[model samples]
Target: MEGDGPGGTGPVHVPFGYIVASEKWRGSQLAQGMQGKIKLVFEDDLTSDFYLSNRSCILYVTEADLVAGNGYRKRLVRIRNSSNLQGIVVVEKTQMSEQYFPALQKFTVLDLGMVLLPVTSQMEASCLIVQLVQEQSKEPSKNPFLKKKRALLPLESCLLRTVQQIPGVGKVKAPLLLQKFPSIQQLSNASIPELAQVVGQAVAQQIHTFFTWSG
Candidate 1:
């Protein structure tokens, strides 16, 4: 959206990430200020039809909304893994971060790359939006050659390494073990019955022996 510039000499068009404002933040000062500063497209629901096609970073007004057990959170996590959209959650400074740290950790573990912004209140949120716009504007174009320079993770090796770290699970069984338990945390905590269900009697006994080995 074009608007009169600060001095009113020309139109100011600030490129912005798609802003999906929640109903709770409607009529707030932050929302009002954002209208003038960026090219905002408002939505009543955080997970709307727009986000499915638009790959813009989401602007959440509160941490609770971002972490809530809802379809919105599910879709956000799905897109983060498959797309380039950044999930930025804005929380008030007055709120304790510890309360939301677990949720943040979950996002990190899922590779969602969710960002947290702790502001004093809604007013500071506007300042953050301005800063984001300025920084985005200054970003240099990417070099096509740099794509080859980026290091790629060896998934098979990494998965084997993690599974093998568990007792009784080695190279031969690590791949099958992972098929049953996708993550190290899950493999480490699986009960004998659960392990046996996937890897059978003898292997389950070996796994149980490894985790229970007290020596």
Candidate 2:
């Protein structure tokens, strides 16, 4: 991370909810549009257009870069290979740059596995950058990229819980009943007399009647 203090140029932490933009971005239209929308700290040492966070970097490819061809790709490849950080390539895709955008998209996204975001102009890229930074600033669990918590698994505790739901089976008796039967199939097939050995005659009858009850 780069320093945010006025002209200090020293290494510093990137505060949450702020952007560390490249010094080259100063005076650009993108920088102008970003004013008040997101807090930016410019640094000359930055390798990309902006560092959304320590884990993510942004590369801006303007209409001029598309006209230049293949050169921007080399820059992208270098950044992708050299850094472990997530790369987001923001490409300007207005009418003039439309033709070149497809090929550029293939190279950056399909080939490199880096994220590609299309914007009509620098202003749109600025807005998208703000959204990206906002997403990064929030708790990781709430981030869109993090997978939603997995569906509940059928764990042993879950099995014991299901067993305890049987009428007359409390927590203690649930495990004891499962110890002999091992599975629902084996437990259900057990006669009341067979189940009596573990849970005693009364609960044995209740357990047997619970699974076998048709009404």
Candidate 3:
């Protein structure tokens, strides 16, 4: 997803975790408050107000903007159509603006498939944005909330697989052997006759030979 502009085709270039704020948004209450928490870069060509990364940006709607009309929707629509940036809307949700938020949420989240975050004031919004930028800067693996692609295998399945790796073991014999011996160390310590109680004598002898074989 390209952010700020169409030409950001490769990697996200967030050097030292800078939040690219729109020139129009510069020196605003949000920008001023964020100065102490993050690095802010002012630019004129961004479709959104703040670019968190090359692929993610934020669009801020103040209480005045919400009460004004659906004007912010046009900006949001432009961002949705122009670039594939992850748009996060930080809207003022005070008593004056709360009535408009439901409709705004529908347009941004339900319609545009963007993230909508509500803050009571510019100060709170600034704090929230700082946390977002900080979290985004960290490697994805370090964030516990993010879903992982590959879930760990269950312990029973792992143990079953380990048992089946022996010389003369299969799915059928592995579970039975594990039920009796439980661990690799315990299984290796079993005498041939003791192993034969679970698996047959031939397989038990083979198992003993596999564990004792120094080759």
Clashes of each: 0, 0, 0
lDDT (Cα) of model 2: 0.67
Task: For candidate 2, write residues 44-130 as lDDT tens digits.
Answer: 766677776654667789998997787888768866775334556788998999888778865764466455667888888788777
Displacement of residue 197 (Cα, Å) in model 2 is 49
lDDT of 1 by residue, 95-153 (tens): 54446544543443234434444566667767665555544445433423112221112
Off by over 4 Å in 2: 1-12, 142-215
- lDDT tens digits, residues 130-164, model 3? 87777665554422312223211122333455467
Assess every candidate by TM-score: 0.42, 0.60, 0.60
Range of the 10 consecutive residues with the lowest summed lDDT in candidate 3: 145-154
Q: Could you tell me the TM-score of candidate 1?
A: 0.42
What TM value does model 3 have? 0.60
Candidate 2 is scored at a TM of 0.60
- Model 3 CA lDDT for position 60: 91
lDDT for every model? 0.48, 0.67, 0.69
In model 3, the clashing pairs are none
